[model samples]
Target: MALRLSLLLLLAILPCIVHPISAAANGRALAESVDAAFWLYEAWPRSQKPARARAPNGFAHHLRLGMGTPPLNSTFVFDTVGALPWAQCQPCVHCLPQEGAIYNPLKSTSFVNLTCPSAGGTGCPYNFSYGGDAFTSGYLATETLTVFGRSFKNITFGCGTLNQGYYDNVAGALGLGRGNLSVPNQLGVDTFGYCFAPRATFFFFGSPPQLVPNTIAATTPIVENPALPSGYFVRLVSVTVGPTSIDVPAASDLLIDSKSPFTFLEPATYALVREALVAQLKPLKEASSAACGAVGLDLCFEADNSTNATPPEVTLRFDGDANLMVSEYLVEMSSRRLLCLAMLPSSKGSFPVLGRRVLMGTPVIYDLAKNVISFQPVDCATFGATFAR
Candidate 1:
């Protein structure tokens, strides 16, 4: 029910935060009490996890640790780092349960959560890495704290980033945000296994050798300079209902393909996740001319997926009570885009339409001064979609 109690509180509170202990008790558990409370970062954008299935920043911020009973205020997300230090985090395994945490309302924001056991959690120590979001893999640490009950103490948050589009030139190359150094280094994957370990990565524009040696898929989701014609894909057609979800264009859809034009994720299920990015859009602009018969199906998508575009899934007729909605965006063919989804959202339904390799691509970026263009499946690094630069 609610994804079955968020998978039973993520397997009963993820073993108190990755634990096992044996190797000489590892300096007696790091001198005594230092199990790194919590850490997770994957502010995704081009990685595709179903656009992180809701709360991917479509606006979410409701923190109330008690009054509203914050048993898990917004299902605190971001959990994927375990190559060791007691690994095994199938994306937090079951998720939902933190007391408070769930961000992703970009005007400014990209995060995963439990920065460090504050609030109802406790206190983190360390476990870092950086690099991943669309292609997968990233981290950060030094794990901060203070989440007991609002003692924010002049709040200060900064992790630069390394999981949602990788960014943290080592805090900006020693000099700190005084940035630039990177190299072929890219983003993260080597070192920082434990000392307590849960997950972390720090870069905040402060660059440096940003990890390497392979933590898992290190760096790969390029294309954003002006490269197209390859296949083009970075879309999210419809889905609305917001006071401010970045001016709002798509509007949070859920039509699912009235016929085949396509449009999904319309409140696809999200009690609370806050921020969990992932995408797979490209509808041209909703393909028309009567469903791409000729001056129509300009829709693109060739990785084998054929397309004629248009199958139905656009409902328009507003004003009466504000009843106009969408989720249609064109850019067709992954075999026409398919998605039925359901390992457990209620235990059934939605897993057909077929198509989601995380919005597959490798080179496609057209910004033209923010007209908006970005696509990357692994590499190609090109896309300039429009930014005329």
Candidate 2:
């Protein structure tokens, strides 16, 4: 099991939900190690099959990894992390605020809503899906991408395939193969035009579909998030590694995922500010009235700037380590407004989930039984590198 969480452990790991509050669970999250999922070929469950177990069969994505060692050799590691998962539990379904929405992160950070197209309403627009029945839950997938190295966490880009998607979960996608995040939707090239990140040469899923104006009106920004602690939707609210672990009270009981990414806060001016924010986490410790309201004040993650050719949007970065986390801006979905961040703990050894930030923008198909996730990035052509298992 990647990281087992027994039911009893749930209470300790998951802070039990009180009216508008999130409960705290107890227990050291079970930890185990498996070879990086992306390093393997033959999809997943099938690879686990006795058949293609010999070599990392599909390591043909060398070109997609980068233009030789120039970019690869220049690998610079930083510290930070971000979101994921699936299921049809009530907690996961939330309505995204569409217009004139007052986003008070302290009281209520965001919203969620699930409307299956077949059921007759708006399904989640983004491919970030939790478990749900096909009739109501939507789609589920576990996708894996075999890149040359672990240089980047989750490299975002538009693929001529799928509907020019977005990267929500990082290593989660790599372990899970790509497919219909929500059942009715399939992110084939026909849907998403060629994906693109301007000025940046690489788009992990390859060139994306053409850019059409997002229907979301500039004035009416729709915010999508399942910020409630109910049913099965659990917000990976914050990850504060290395810093508060010892000083914080009974902090060890918290469910710090194994192989989880670490956002190393290098001591810079930005680091100093992040240190202050660490002290103020008291209000955000739970989804209390003030915490809900404080959501809007989460300046630790984003900034408002408009130097780019396109209109502005929100982006995320380290609280104080701005210089190190700066490059992450290129892959940020928007750069003008604000984004959200949860405190994640630090990791000693780098794993796929910990090293890379965002993997595929498209949601994936995670066949638990098969133990493999496959994604058709544009075409199989982008796949390179040689794999021997």
Residue 34, model 1, lDDT? 23
lDDT of each: 0.21, 0.22
Model 2 stretches with alpha carbons more than 4 Å out:
1-251, 257-273, 276-297, 301-336, 344-389
How many pairs in model 2 have backbone atoms within 3 A of each other, for residues 3 or more apart or on separate chains, i.e. clashes? 117
lDDT of 2 by residue, 1-389 (tens): 22221211101112211111111110011001112132222332232221121112111111122211122111111101112222212122332221122122122212223333433453322243222321112222111212434332111211111111222111112112222111101111111111111111122222222222342111111112233111111112123322432122211111112122222221232244345544543332322334323543223333243232232221221112110111222222243333333223333332112112222221112222232222222221232221121
Tell me model 1's lDDT, rounded to 2 decimals.
Answer: 0.21
> Model 1, poorest ten-residue lDDT window?
175-184
Cα RMSD (Å) between model 2 and the true structure? 20.8
Runs of candidate 1 with Cα error greater than 4 angstroms are 1-250, 253-264, 267-358, 362-389
Question: Best by TM-score, which number?
Answer: 2
- Estimated TM-score per prediction? 0.19, 0.20
- The backbone clash count of each candidate, in order, is 94, 117
